[model samples]
Target: MTRRRVLETAAFGAAALAGSRPAGAAQAPNVVFIMADDLGYADVAAYGRPDLATPHIDRIAARGIRFTQAYANSAVCSATRTALITGRYQYRLPVGLEEPVTTRFAGGLPAEHPTLPGLLRQAGYRTALVGKWHLGSVQDYGPLQRGYDAFWGFRGGTIDYFSHRGTDGKPDLWDGDLRIEEVGYATHLLGERAVRTIAASVKAGRPFFLSLHFNAPHWPWETPDDEAESRRIAGSNLRHFDGGTQATYRRIVAEMDTQIGRVLDALEANGVAEDTIVVFTSDNGGERFSDTWPFTGRKTELLEGGLRIPAIVAWPRRLKAGAISAQPMITMDWLPTLLSAAGAAPDPAYPSDGIDLLPILTGQAPERPRTFFWRYRANDQAAMRDGDLKYLKIRGETFLFDVVADPLERANLKARRPDDYARLRAAWDTWNATMLPERPDSFSETYTGGQLADHFGAGGAPTPPRPALAGEAPR
Candidate 1:
């Protein structure tokens, strides 16, 4: 047998041995990681958004834990995804910032980095990725090289949901290496693929690790139906609405939620619901929509609105039902948490920035010590959240806010808390010194005049408006 086959067989043997233990003994739970692209904290029903309903996503929180202060490492797709996969700050790698849709950056999650899937796969889980895979298009960075056994998705950040075409005007859908044109809404198709992958893994008698990354509510706002769009478009004045794009965004999110329910149903039908862990979160914060009200700024900005997002972890058998945690966790934490939960050790060579969150989730651990930092090179925005205090710098304008007291960041205390600001600045500087200079490909000079307008769209608007999904902004 080949080396890979040998490893696979050995992993199966180990799983079988573990399975022979007494019934109800703790076993590695099947992990279903569902990440929505550009979803906001207030966009779901449980988060307090009454305008839109997200019964499926809210159900995860109803059955599990809902985190109030979870954040994405960055405000954009590629950066946050890198942090999620490697359990390290994105700045530690080349091309850590968000990339344009057309350009293929050389920097991707290095093979040597211990990704969540890689660590889980080593511990006998069958891994598959459905939907977006923005890590990299280079052979070494593809899902297959990064420990996923199967990949069915696009490599770009956002694609035309209906046509499966990328922002660069090319067909971006792929099944493994071969490009495949899939008919139907992208969100629904992704869910279908996820269910199929989960069912197949169960049939093969192996625990599964499925990363269902849906690119809904991201851009090119198109939905499964027109009524959903009409409802959202009726009140919005964003230019994208000129072509009934708001309807598309609304329908896309509704469809995404529906499809999510389908995946949950599949898990229940397969008898894995009790033993499976379903994690629902977003790649970054919301954009263009008024959904992220009370929190300032949108995606691409280093503000609470762009960083703070919804995070739900549902493991009915292992966690207390209907619990909520205020622990300040970030996307990077998933790697260590998943590995620890699966009884797998993180690779020693690739030390992780994230700590095991199992303790926090299980009510064993009380808090995290480390501060969270984010730097988006393109926009020259940086933020550091330490304890209850947060310091942000945008284009050299510094501001400090006691996030605990001012969750909305409306109160700037930089003048009153000079010492605190200095300390946070020092901490940020220390962290920044450790990271390599932004990769050449990752750096972009400021756009001037009309060039900027043309790139972002006329009048600096996002190419497509944000989705009016469920959830409420921080009060």
Candidate 2:
């Protein structure tokens, strides 16, 4: 029998076994999706990062389902987030890119697009966003305009954690429609706000959907005093600091992990630990001090290291504990999966590129049948994964790899597997032909070369000095 037939039969069997309760029957579980910015695949202790201890993040994997072969839709923040919120490939829209900025254009997530929050709200759930909202800056593209009932975060790509100010000198912090001055670190503040929102929802006895996007360990890294002290106790070298930049970065990540623990504790305190569904992931691969070892490349490139990210889902009441699934899920899949868990049906007007992950999560389905496709317009790179084989093209060089065997993408099998390459390439060609041309404004000329330094007021100077090696001791 075909895979589809098998899945359908299994679903039926599960439903019949459930009797009064359907196979997927349950109250809409409260969803708290926590996303880290620019985190690497191997950065968390759960993923085998020996240097960094991420106990709380590791706890999520141990208590729930951990995805081994999951990936972001794009290699950069804005593009991946767009796919996540809309449940469609970002390339389908005009704003998709490896790097996107608001000042370059007036583009925003189109008003017609049906957002995840909007769908959940329609299903009688309160939705809120409590972190970065880089989809757009125009009044209409703001979180309030997009589907969220409440928004309290920044609209820019990166901001100072302490000052809550962007490089452009604008107040990146907001509470609803007004700009608010927040004192503590960005990661901690976002976490505290999330807890408060959950507490308020519990008081009202209303189900909620929260997108907690934390801009931690991204750049301009800064750590809290307590976090820095903990690192010192661990025998980390931060003395004679020489600006102590790398020390600051490591401490920032550790503290971010601590804040995540806070969120988990709050859920337990509110007596909603079992009923709430929590998902932890990153917007893209890691960069700078962040590590994505075993994977190649970083945020701006179309490599395994750049695209692959850590994804863990925890739904104690429903999903089996400590389960690990190797299914190749993507960012777009979350929308449909969460909506399904919330008992929300897909909107016919806003058809999604994602499929419901209920079958896979519940063990009713063994694997996903459809191939995954990715196209980053700004860099003109494209990739497609069919079964275990992946066809990749970056900078006009084409290659293929068996991703299952070579998750790090160390070996290329394009010459030997010409038939597989040809088929995937043809499929990609057909898919590419149907896509709309990237909108004219999507391309930015800022990072072309020396132009960036000039824009940052380096006065036509050479690149800034690199920090000393992380553990280098003074002479």
Candidate 3:
């Protein structure tokens, strides 16, 4: 559709929606979107971790549906978050193309862009974000400027769990644009704030959309007991790749799960458990000390492990409990799904790249096939999934796998299934043509000496960084 026609349709829809009350505004389900950063597909006990206990996370699975084929929009946090908020492919916007946005990145989600929270707010829902707003800087682009009515979080990718400082040695904690200092572990602090938001929303008798994005099991590898480790890494980088152990990772995940339990408890305490819609998932794949067993490769790779995530949804009022679904879904699907449940819709001017999965999720429809595409400039990597078949290309090698049968991606069937392989490859090319082209100067996560060796093999050479594409300034 033409841009002008789309905008005109959007204007008409907005006017019509404004004049009418939401289908069930008085009893609209309160949405609690809880996301964990860099959590592996099997990190929680519910998914299949053997060494850790995630009773709270497991509880969520038991209370609702668990999706085995869920995926993040990107292999990185910021990119996936952009898709989540905008309900579109991350590549559609310059800001989403950052791979993972950094403080040096020059753009963010445009304030004028239609966002999940913004649309929900217009539908008579109170919106708040309690943790991790890495979309952009607080100075120019922030949660308040975008969609969130109340924001209490940091504007960085990862922060010191105890000190709440960014890797740049700057205090990154905030209370709605104002930087603030709070003495506590970042995970616990965010959880506490989220509970408070829930309480406030309940008291006000308004349906709320709380985005509880947590930076857990992501980096710095510090639990509340690791304050000394936090102090040790204070002046240095928060990536503390040299630190962290399986036990430490366990503790971090455990703490996050505990905090989630608290948030769930608050819902029950406020007598809204059955009416609230709670979604628990991850931003991307896991990092070091993460167990993504059965799926080879980790974050940044286009492998199944990097893209697949654990997704659980609980809304006792509308969804059946303890259901398991094999339906393939991506991060962008959430916006349209939640909006449908709330009696709202995406802006017609920017139609969602995702479909409303509410019908399928609520058992109103059967499982269906889906097509997805992905690309990462670092290794010249690209991937496409069409049903059970996946076509992957990294460096200069091509591979075809039935990911449904070989979750480990150990078997390549390109030679045997040439036709299917060629079809998927062609489909990827067609889809890529529709999205924004990759800018040569765009920044992607890179590794140094030892890190390069860890990622590649010993004596491996790193791909040199490139400047921006011709005539295109870095976003």
- Find the candidate with the highest lDDT and give its number: 3
RMSD, each candidate, Å?
6.9, 10.9, 5.5
* TM-score of each model, in listed order: 0.86, 0.83, 0.92
lDDT per residue (tens digit) for residues 1-475 in model 3: 2466446534643554455474544667899999999999999898889999999988888999999999999988899999999999999998888877765676799878999998987776778999988888887888877877789989888888888878667889998778999999989999999999999988867678999999998898898899998888788767786788999999999999999999999999999999999999999988777888779877877888888988999998988889999999999999999999988899999999998999998778999999888987767779999999999997768999999999999899999999998999999999999999988667776444476445644222134345434432211
lDDT (CA) per prediction = 0.75, 0.75, 0.85
Which 10 residues in a row give candidate 1 its minimum summed lDDT? 466-475
lDDT of model 3 at position 183: 94
Steric clash count of candidate 1: 8
Q: Which candidate should be chosen as best, given TM-score against the real structure?
A: 3
Residue 396 displacement in candidate 1 (angstroms): 1.4
Model 2 clash count equals 0
Put down candidate 1 lDDT per residue, 132-207, tens digits, no spaces: 9887783557887787878899887766666666644567898876788877778878989998998998886767
What root-mean-square deviation over C-alphas does model 2 reach?
10.9
Candidate 2, run of 10 with poorest lDDT? 458-467
Q: Tell me the number of clashing residue pairs for each predicted model.
A: 8, 0, 2
Q: Spell out the clash pairs found in candidate 3.
A: 441-467, 441-468
Where does candidate 3 stray beyond 4 Å? Answer: 1-26, 447-449, 452-454, 458-475
Query: CA lDDT of 384 in candidate 2?
Result: 91
| Candidate 2 accuracy as lDDT | 0.75
Candidate 2: clashing pairs of residues? none
